[model samples]
Target: MTPSEYGFLKQFLKSRSGLVLSDEKQYLVESRLVPVTRRTGHKNLSALIADLGPRGSEDLKNTVVEAMTTNESFFFRDKTPFDHFRNTMLPNLLEGRRSQKRIRIWCAAASTGQEPYSLGMCLQEDRHKTAGFRFEILGTDISTEVLEKARTGVYSQFEVQRGLPIQMLLKYFTQQGELWQVSPELRAMVQWRKLNLLENFSHLGTYDIIYCRNVLIYFDQDTKRDVLQRLAKQIPEDGYLVLGAAETVVGLSDAFEPVPQHRGLYRPRKQGAAASPRLGSAFPTLKAMNS
Candidate 1:
């Protein structure tokens, strides 16, 4: 692809998906869009780029945006976030929402449903403690393709082996030919939707916990701050926001404050005052159970 075409693609992706492609990522763009060219009969990346503006095919524009959005995910990815979920987040919500008897969670960047499903598995294991509570999980992604795969709840042998415990695999999934499918019950726990974080998402309503992990790394500082502030609106002051280990709110926005010792966990800051103190983060991770 020519430099001009690459530049147009970079801007197109930024406006459409809040993705920021640096100069060094020209090769990355070329590599990721090659399949789009073959599938759509565009002949080359430049041809695809030419067809992407207001006069271009809307379907092609969406396809290109989806192609550029990264959807890498696995069960209990990064380990520590799930550890915070099971050990810290869940317990707090269970107590805080006892009167309401219902708790909502949003996996803001859910890709192929691993993160939401992992939370479902955690809820299942704690059934004895949460006997009478109702849990609602919403998993949204920009890629309809990944959402479709998530709805099907199927994973290949290699996919399941990554960070997925053998015991949980045996308990929650059934071997279907070469792939494993999560139980219908577990799949039903998460509702999937196609969403672009850059657009308005207030209609989806509030949640007790929101996991917007790994996705912010792709956004420039301005876009990151915009997304983070919007995300803060969907969470109540007492609610939680979980970001990737590499992402943080300290430098960008003060809408949230880090939970003590929990690396990737943050709770919404109270308006006009500091965030409330929480219990210590000395809670043990689920390593033994997962192992």
Candidate 2:
């Protein structure tokens, strides 16, 4: 892609959805968007962008953008967070939110739906604890197509094995030909929707726990800070925010501090702790929302 072409597409993408494509990822732009050429009846990449330049239908524009949005995800991608959630966080959050008897979990970048469903499956391990609570595992992503797959709760064997444990797999998934489908019970736990973190998610309100993992690394520092601040507004003081282990709120935003229980997991500061965001509205304190 030429610099001029890159600039045009970058602006279009950022405007439609808060995605930033660095120059180094120029190849990614070409490789991903090539499919759009064939789909849109264009002979090549340049033609696809050129044809879409004027009077492109809303659906076509959306298809182009959705194609650009990365939807790579696997069962548990990173093992540590699930481990932390299961052994430490879930126990604490369940204990703290015990009286409320309800919990809301948001998986911010729930690409193709595996992460949130994985959380649901992990929670499935302890059914008794969740007996009285209202558990709603909300999964959101910027890409509508991926959101659709998440709602379906079906997966191929390769998809199921990515981060799933064998025992859990046997317990919660069923084999149908070559594909593995998650039990309806686990699938029913999550609700899917389209949400962009770059935009204000304040309307969604506070959540006991949020999983916005692994998606921040692609953003510029300013964008990271803004998104984190906005996320803080929808969370309460005791709320838990989990980011990718490689990612951090450390110089990005001062709203949260790493929890001692799980080194990478964080809790929001009270009204005047350190550089906590003034707009902080933590939904609830959760040692873990395992149930």
The list of candidate 1 runs beyond 4 A from truth reads 280-284
In order, the Cα lDDT scores of the candidates are 0.90, 0.78
lDDT of 1 by residue, 22-94 (tens): 9999888888899999999988877888889789998898898888889899998998888888778888877
TM-score of 2: 0.88
Candidate 1 yields a Cα-based lDDT of: 0.90
Q: Which digits, one per residue and each the tens of the lDDT, describe model 2 over residues 15-103? A: 77778888787898899898788777878877777756768778888888899888889987676677766665566667678888877
Overlapping backbone residue pairs in candidate 2 total 14
TM-score of each candidate structure, all chains considered together = 0.96, 0.88
Question: Which residue pairs in model 1 clash with each other?
Answer: none
